[model samples]
Target: MSSYPPSVPPQSSAQQASQPTGLRQRLADLRGPAVPPRPLDARALAALAANPGCGRRALLDGAGVDKTVLAEALGSPAPFGQSQFAIVRGNSFEAKVKSDGGAELLRLVHAHLDPGGEAPGPDARVPDLSAAGPEGRAARTALALREATAAGAWTLLDHPMLALEVAGTPAYLEPDAVVVHPDGRWTVVEIKSFPMIDGAADAAKVGAAARQAAVYVLALERTAGKLPGARAGHTVLLVCPKDFSNLPTASPVDVRRERAVTRRQLERLTRVEELAAALPAGLGFGPERTAEERAAAVAAVEAAYAPECLAACELAFHCREKARAADEVTALGRSVRGELGALTTVEGALAAAAGPGAAEDPTAAALYRAALLRAEALEPVG
Candidate 1:
């Protein structure tokens, strides 16, 4: 999905100085004359960690280029669309969970994570996080958090805005909810519409929710770090519909591992400044630019294409086509790429396994043996 950067107030000098001179303008120029940097959500940002070597995703995302648009323009549109049923179901479930000043939400938090703790009273504060832009709302949320912590009350921040600096750009994030405990501890609440069948949810969905919540935990930790004695809980509340009904059941999902993975993945990202420096003299991805020009500009940067990228990245189709044309071994998978060593292409890998040097190379030797075993097995069947 394409989004323009929110109209945020001016940044402080410290924020400005975080970037080198001309970096922002250069990134803007790369995106095109009029395109706004597409705000990267936690989900998109987290996917980057999974594909660490994809320089194209990093640079395009850093520059805020709209990959959905870019992919369509390149004649390989991304097959991504949410069913209206899901959109409505998610919204309805979340609203039900947070209804009545988040009374139900507090109950679930108390029931799942802190069963021994006192339940929040009717007067539990649900902070109005409304503001002019993402930055303003994020600041407003931070202030509310501090006040709630100081007051030592149960506070629910509904849809709090957060900003995480990624690749020299601020990626704005909004979590489902952030709950402040009376004891100054904070918990992130992820409300999902997916039903927990027989008290068990889908593992993949749970994992995705955890990874997404990990990003919120990271953002919340930043806020907690500034306050004395205030700590963000490593365990997040994953609230889902129970047994296909609207009733919300909660589980305490430990996101410590996901958090560490995300943190490392984000850190491993190639800096936008370094990427911009490596670019050719003039390259632009503006909507007005010709399809060929835009494709060439995108091609100038390398992409680490994998089968999994098809699920997460808009440019997967285009990249997969390119990988196929080049016979890149990575198109099969990273595991295959690792086994091939210096043989980056399928033809090269086959050649290596058949060559005399196969005996000297461990990977080639293994492939050579595996090929023989497969051939023998198939011959008997024939």
Candidate 2:
């Protein structure tokens, strides 16, 4: 999707004037007066959906605070980044796939997504989406989408920007490419460097890609909703390398399930204004703030920590440390946490299992039985 230096849609003067100054100032204060807010991408949004209960993450993201930097300040820097070599390879492959005025890309789209429809010809449109800023580019992309839908032609939007409101803030997203079919259907095209061997790729990678693409589809739907007779397709084109070669191959991945799940999770998020309003006064996440201050600020808000947060959240390491210190059972894993009903802490679960109450509580009885079995298995096996 879109790279850093986030391209949020600019609010009209009247719209800006109408906003409550108190909430906006609070968010700005949390982000720091001088620091710019990092723009949220599809990947970040998907991660947010994966762990929707983390109010800490929700507020940080909504305010556009740079979590990578914030994580570093907390001494638990996020362990994710692309290597320079991988970056070069991805860029090269993407350029090759979109070459020849995206002729190959369009051909693949037609063959895979709409084979029964008319094939894309040389006359297919690749409209100019260039504009002065992110807001302009987003508006221009929307206009192009509308025109393409009205004209009923095959079109390709390269790196077009889109905006989705999350937690009362607009998050700008950019898909690798969005293909407009001849029948006015919009399909998101994701280009990745991973190899597809024997018509299959890594399942985990594909799942992650699907979740990210689902975000793009959701944003596309918002844009298409205002246009008559326009609809965003549920299936997306996942373009990747063929085996070890740079030759491009594509698969149609259905994202209806992911879309539904993400939509529900997004809806469940607590609004940013609400989260900010709940924070104590003078709580700032600016780089100049001391580590103790930052830690205290973060701890003031409750975080639902789980192992999955390691992959999806920047502050996961810090949260994990806090959870372990407090003996919170949620740090074990979501499944484990779910299975230990009413036992929020490890000590509490252990006490329940070893105490007289074990027989009265089903969960405690099960844990007690498991503990006995474990002790028996470890009994100095001769």
Q: How large is the C-alpha RMSD of every model relative to the true structure?
A: 3.2, 2.6
- How many residue pairs clash in all the candidates, one count each? 0, 0
lDDT of 1 by residue, 100-168 (tens): 999999998988887777688999998788986676788899999999999999899988888788767
- Residue 153's lDDT within candidate 1 is 90
Give one digit per residue, the lDDT tens place, for model 2 in 196-299: 99999999999999999999999999999999989999999999999988899999999999999999999999998899989999888888799888988899
Best by TM-score: 2
Instruction: Assess each prediction's global lDDT (C-alpha) against the native.
Output: 0.83, 0.86
Model 1 lDDT at residue 109: 91
